[model samples]
Target: MTLDELRATAAARHDTCAQIKKMIVSRLDLPIEPAWITDDQPLFGRGLELDSLDVLELYVAIEAEFGVALYDSDMSVFGSVSRLADHVNPALAERAPTGSA
Candidate 1:
């Protein structure tokens, strides 16, 4: 791909990650800014401190917002914002950043 094409792809991935962060914060009513969440930040356990309930909420929110059903997906899909981005927006999978999950 050309330089502009590469940049566009990166931008799209960044946008998708940002959207996921916003959705997480809004859906969960977190007290932090969406930009504060890094693309590779973990979504559960000691990372975001999310629990199983939060996962259910995220499942609904993801479907309503992205029209993607993640109910049958495993926990790895929620490994990180960038990882989630890949599932919600499959076009990014080919160029997904390292350590996303």
Candidate 2:
């Protein structure tokens, strides 16, 4: 692809990541800004300190906000904001960065 197309793809992924971060923060009622969460930051346990309850909330919120249902998916889907972005926005899945999943 051309440089412009590559940049546009990156921009789309970045935007999706940002939206996931905001959804996590808002849906989970976390005491932090959405921008504070990095695209690669972990979403559970040691990373964002989320738990099973948080994941349930996210499943519902994701469906409502992004029109993607992740309830039947595995826990790996919550590996990070970038990973979740791939699921919520399948267009990004093809161009997802290595190890983002």
Candidate 3:
């Protein structure tokens, strides 16, 4: 699985940006992205309104959903939604489509 495969999977299951935002919000238990979480915005710092705790939650969420173990130092890699998509893509590629998420 590569980043391309991961993006393909996420896009396929998530479909619209709104749906993708909902999936992230629900999975990570964040009151975020009521609209669409822009692919271009940072999901960290004061950028997309995320804090370190959110990153911790995201670590858990990513581990659970994609079966990828994200290191504490690796949090920097997930700064943006695009990065998260990149980080999680290969792992997702290994999983067979569960059908419509």
Candidate 4:
């Protein structure tokens, strides 16, 4: 890919990360800014300390916001924001209209 293509891909990933963080905070009612979520920080346990119910809520929110249907086998990607983005970006790309950057 050209440098421009690489830049575009990076920008799209960044946007998706921000959107996911916002959805997490809003759907979970967390008192945190989207920017406060680091890409590699865990979303559960000692990190954000979310529980199973929170994960369920987040799943619902993700489906509603991104039109992606995640399955039980896909749960491993929820470990961190970056991992979530990696799982989600392809689905988002599929949903994006042709020629949109």
Each candidate structure's TM-score, on Cα atoms with residue i matched to residue i, is: 0.91, 0.91, 0.59, 0.79
Model 1 off-target regions past 4 Å?
97-101
lDDT of 2 by residue, 2-98 (tens): 9999898889999999999988888888899999999989888889989998888898999999999988998888888898899999999987654
- Specify the highest-lDDT model's number: 1
How does model 2 fare in lDDT? 0.89
- Ranking of candidates on TM-score, top first: 1, 2, 4, 3
lDDT of 1: 0.92
Q: Which of the predicted structures, 2 or 4, would earn the higher lDDT when compared with the native?
A: 2
lDDT of 2 at 3: 100
- Residue-level lDDT tens digits of model 3 in 1-101: 79998788776534433443565789667665545577656777766777777777767767777676776555556556655655566453345332341
lDDT of each: 0.92, 0.89, 0.62, 0.78
TM-score of 1: 0.91
Q: Residue 96 of candidate 4: its Cα lDDT?
A: 40
RMSD values, in order shown: 2.2, 2.0, 8.7, 6.7
| Model 4 steric clash pairs | none
- With a 3 Å backbone cut-off (N, CA, C), the pairs that clash in candidate 1 are none
Residue 37 error, candidate 4, Å: 0.4
Query: Can you write out model 4's per-residue Cα lDDT over 16-57, one digit (the tens) per residue?
Result: 889899999889888989899987679888888889899888
